[model samples]
Target: MFARASEDGFIHDMVLYYGKTTLEAHDVPLKPEQEGLGATSQIVSVLASTMSFPTTTAIFADSFFTSLELVRYLQDHNCRYTGTARDNRIGKPQLGTIKEMEKKAVPRGTCYYVTSDDGILAVRWKDNKTVILLSTDMGEGPMSTVLKYCSESKKREPVGCPAVTRSYKANLGGIDKSHQVLPMKSNRRYLRLFAYVIDVSLTNAWVVYKRDCKALGVKCQPLKDFKL
Candidate 1:
């Protein structure tokens, strides 16, 4: 499977067969009634069960897919992962409450991070919002700047945030955009899946066409025009 983002939206070139193949390779029993698994853990378990990563690889995910347990699991396999997490998730360090932080007036662009004994990096940064991230591969400091909307200035302002956060902001939209544009709604499950596959194929083609056109210094066809 491939994941990417474009004007059309977040797209993943997924094959259902690959999911099944991964499951089979791991000898995962075909049984239900699994309990004591948080929703995030189940998602991570599926990914970890199916895929093996090289030591240099890093996986990035959003809050819904992130947990300290997942990071440790990936680390145990010599892989790295970076992702945002909810404040309420278990196994995370007990940072001060959000309300207390607000009362203390945590400044915009302020960031704090702790490196666990096991070397997991947990960071908290305040922009217009406060976001917490867990990573096995990110440094404890900001190495880049990003443009964010400032309500007081009524304009975009550059603020410094961690490099991992910068990377996440840049690539997080790929899946979201695909969901927005690919309007697949069919009563039959198989038909809906078929349409989704076609949508991904077209999007991937568009990406390749745009890349090749750019490299050749040729005028790129608009997606709408290319669709014709």
Candidate 2:
């Protein structure tokens, strides 16, 4: 399943994975450039179409749903996106190689970034491991500091973190949080998808209820009580 969720864990929309043929049969539109992309990219495109354009909706996702083409597509549609990217999916940007980034001589917080002509930024940063991120709305500058445990010194120390990385880390858990609140139980083989759909419906309704309560200045119950 693929879902578009808010930072506070409100699920806006979702699509069950039914393969490319099903998507085509449903007449889901895809740009010419997006035609041959992987299934994950296609899913992103379909979910994004459900959103209103030019709202500056910031999308945060993991490597499974991020690619250079998808980032470009989001940018063209006036949406902002930041996500971890697989090295191969980022194209041959003039960024450091994994070997160079992992060398002993390199500093732990070292970072390199390059912006494409179309204004997509690809950032490569080193912490305990190398992380490559892509963004349409962030830059390399104005870095933030994050606390990291230093095993050698046995103390926690501050490490420089890129803005894109920081944003992705902050916003990437919406779907996971949504799942935690409305977990689905194991069911008979044919009933599994139906159970998942019911859970998602309940979660979305619960989120909207909480929002309405807050807006109306009314006290809200916990999800368990609200469900009852």
Measured by lDDT, the strongest candidate is 2
lDDT values for all models: 0.65, 0.84
Candidate number of the best TM-score: 2
Clash totals, every prediction: 5, 0
**Listing every candidate in turn, what is its Cα RMSD in Å to the true structure after a full C-alpha superposition?**
5.2, 1.9
lDDT of 1 at 193: 75
Q: 58-121, model 2: which lDDT tens digit per residue?
A: 8889988899988988788788889998999999999999899999999899999999999999
Question: Per-residue lDDT tens digits of candidate 1, residues 158-209?
Answer: 8878876776676556567656656568999789778878877776676677
User: Which residue pairs collide in model 1, if any?
Assistant: 9-177, 10-174, 10-175, 10-177, 10-178
Clashing pairs in 2: none
Model 1 compared with the native: what TM-score?
A: 0.71
